[model samples]
Target: MRPSGLRHHHRLETRAVTRFEPNLRIPGPTSLPPSVREAGGRQMINHRGPEFAAMLGRIQTGMRPYFGTQSEIAVLSCAGTGGLEAAVVNVLSPGDRVLGVSIGAFGDRFAKIAEVYGAAVDRVSAEWGHAARPDEVRERLRGGDYRAVLLTHNETSTGVMNPIPDLAAAIHQESPETLILVDSVSALGAVPFEMDGWGTDVVVTGSQKAWMAAPGLAMVAASERAWAAMEIAQMPRFYLDLRRHRESARSGETPWTPAIAVIYQVDEGLRLMAAEGAENVFARHEACAAATRAGLEGLGFELFADAANRSTTVTAAWIPDGVDWKAFNGEVKRRGVVLAGGQGKLAGKVFRVGHLGSVTVDEILGAIATLETVSVTAGRPVEVGAAVAAAQRAAIEAGIARVPVAAGA
Candidate 1:
């Protein structure tokens, strides 16, 4: 008696169901805000035009406070790894001695890049879940005349953030002339970094991690000392040359064609971050991290990272015994919650939850609820809602107030 469309509408009205919402819980390429998404869809612009120059200038200025530097910022059209390569190629000459302080996989990669570029790379490695202690670094620096030392500000693979200030101080004290090159790709915006204050020479970061933008641009900060190195250091470089980037940036341009759309997204993302205030943004990340850790603890999951070294950007937890990791992940995904599996040596042992870049405590609470539900579906039943409740308390305790979804978070 009714048309197909009317019958379909009648069937939908007869039952209750909620819309599917996906939570992308990964270390990087975080979910974007609506305005950021719209900005990224803007029509292409001439790379050398005035409009692009103005936008590039704004981004360069906006990035200063987050980087805690007044030094030159080179906006390169590449991922974070490319930025690290730039740091290596532009600063040190072939056969230069380098110390790589590795806490996790990314840390190792920084060293590997230096080695590939012909530097004599020696490593001071810490256990996977722990951070590199200052004492060990101090001891190592005392023994060698290292030209530069590569450090990771945050190791997302293991969910650990190194004590940069302390490590930098130790390096300077032991080897005062050694340049401090930091890979802050996963930490800069989410965590606090003081490039000049900490005497860091080069700090490289990416657009995707905490900037709430797509994976296209790698931003690097170079101190005066680092620029001086560029004058004499002789590692072969053309495309990833910081000197070229620095020169072109004087006119608000990139060395090559830039990722125009990603810059648009970064422009909007920087605007959102500025409106939120830097301190508040840091606090929000802290609150979300605390909530995530508390929630995981409530679910009887052992955290992979050490308590004192846990990263605010991502939280890694051990996959519980008696539960199939693949099955558990599938269940979580089926419910529209996508979590990150462990990397490197932790491949089958841990799972990571990313909570940064416009992520709110409420969103984390939802993910926690999903995890609790999925755990039950996997036959590991615990008290329902306990993890969510724990997360709520932790967030509140971390000075987070309930905020609107669009309140510049």
Candidate 2:
């Protein structure tokens, strides 16, 4: 018998199960490597010291490849959302007409941020779990007098990755002067995003997401066009002022007191990623997402996002019918794997499995196995073992690792 969150009557197991240090499977503040943890534990140093400058230098240089910009990158003591706000306030003024290109919840949040700051936002929406297409963006741009455009590289809520390059092209073709601001919070370092190549003016990300580091730091990179907008755009910003940050970055420092501990951890994480190679990291994330999705489908689960727009960082899916998703999620947690529950309208309708950052093949399979045990105990048993095998096979096919035997064996 297993512990059930459902009070309506479910099997109960007297054999107690204890799992320590549950596997974290959330989109941000992802699983950190031992080295990053140790780095964070180091004694505090002078934020204005030479040592700090060197550390900051290393972080900036190492992270540039992933940010896909030769331009300056600024690290702020803020999360990804803060970075998005900074991008908006710095580039556009109050009542400035902006186009919000939304695919899911996060994209909606991006637009709301602009609206809150007094930007007149006109949104172009796509169905939940589906990405915004280029044709739709071009259509929106055709008639609007937008001063800036807001886009999200990855929609964590619905597990969708938009076609940013194509969208950028359409925006450029229709409204070349409008600043393009992108939220790459959960996508950078884990997916293919070339900011400079795509001609994006501003792109922002956080240290916690695919950086495999702790939270408390947001990174922003800007092209010359965005910096030009910052010079004239006035939105009464003080703490998030990028002009001050830009000047400070030249001196290898931040405009304000930074998150020194998270910075230390980010330095280590960036070091590891640099050694791993950017292309390799992206490949691993893609392979892991593929394997996780295949495993979920094998277990008789339906994916929430469309296959054509599925994200490589997280996989969102509906729990099988006849099983309370909350109860099923609790079982997974009790078994030592904490998956992220959905939010907003998605709520219990979906569960998200984050496979980005440092997630490995073994971790995915272990979580699947735990879900299998819980599902069977819940009386909705499926041959999840075969699904586990499918994941292993997919990994092998992706050149991630070799499998001893297939699931049927």
Candidate 3:
């Protein structure tokens, strides 16, 4: 037998369980409401069961107001990219001419997806951190005979929000037959997206972003014109078949097994969002974005995107001189705050701050405080109190702050 002292010396290692804090800093997979999380924990139902059908029908009905469309909502057991693929495959045939506007990584992905589907993709490249103007898109559409035009309503990577209404009007004016497919993954709910009123043929979004639910599900709404185009298109598709989804959804079911847990969460999240009112949700995003920008400016960090085109979901800030971005990011992480790094060609030069679904003024303030501490500690000269104060001022002006406070008070 071992000695008595040795027996008492056994170390008990206790690991700290990471608590689920609301994600108030980024655009997607934002903080889920407690009610949504509770719903996600509900007992799973059979995919083909009546309960599932009822849930699916209720979700489709809930999505209508967010999309601002009377078109059928196709729920797919995939991410936003799946919805993008569905849009490409369902409405266009192989060797069809398509024009894709590329302002950031997501836009580039759209062009790549089109190419993979055997479309003759013409990329209209624009400078990163800026929106491609309607006139520019118009020029490209007028210059070629294309079957469709692809655009992103919000380029999350560069924090640029495109002017969709004006762009749609321009496309219709120049090439009325060219179908319009928009990736509203980051813009839906956070911004006003009127698919029917704007004449967009197809709009795709995911549950994670503005929906404030877990990932793994995508939603698409296709106009009658887009459905008509799908009827004659020769593109090959099976699991992502919009036609099948449309048919099944009409019957209040899905062609395949749905992510029951995620659907439960999505249903609850959408219910909460609808109850708060879509316009109010959009306004919250706008105010949060403005506050974030004002806070960053107050800290003396330069914004990467133009003011007019700034995304309501995220903001890209250039790394100031003398600050070690890596170290600063590490410090923020150590403080239990996570921020997104720049993607593509912007890596290391900038960082993204998300202000989308479920974010609050206090969370934004906490992040700003962390930023201020890290920047100052890393030898980057920043006005410590300025950013937080500016954010507080913005919160008050937007009526988000319950108690009024002066800008510098």
Best by lDDT: 1
Per-residue C-alpha lDDT of model 3 across residues 305-358, encoded as one tens digit per residue: 988899989999998777777877877776667888888999888899988766
lDDT of each: 0.90, 0.85, 0.84
Candidate order, TM-score descending: 1, 2, 3
Task: Please identify model 1 stretches exceeding 4 Å from their true place.
Answer: 1-21, 401-409
Error of 2 at 160 (Å): 0.3
- Clashing residue pairs for model 2: 1-12, 1-13, 2-13
Strongest candidate by TM-score: 1
User: What tens digits encode model 1's per-residue C-alpha lDDT throughout 171-245?
Assistant: 999999999999999999988889999999999999999999999999999999999999999999999988888
lDDT digits (tens) for residues 324-406 of candidate 2: 77766776777788888787889878889998777777888887777767777887758748888988788777768322111
C-alpha TM-scores of all predictions: 0.94, 0.93, 0.91
List ranges where model 2 is wrong by over 4 Å.
1-17, 401-409
Backbone clashes, each candidate: 0, 3, 1
Q: Which of the predicted structures, 2 or 3, would earn the higher TM-score when compared with the native?
A: 2
Ranking by lDDT: 1, 2, 3
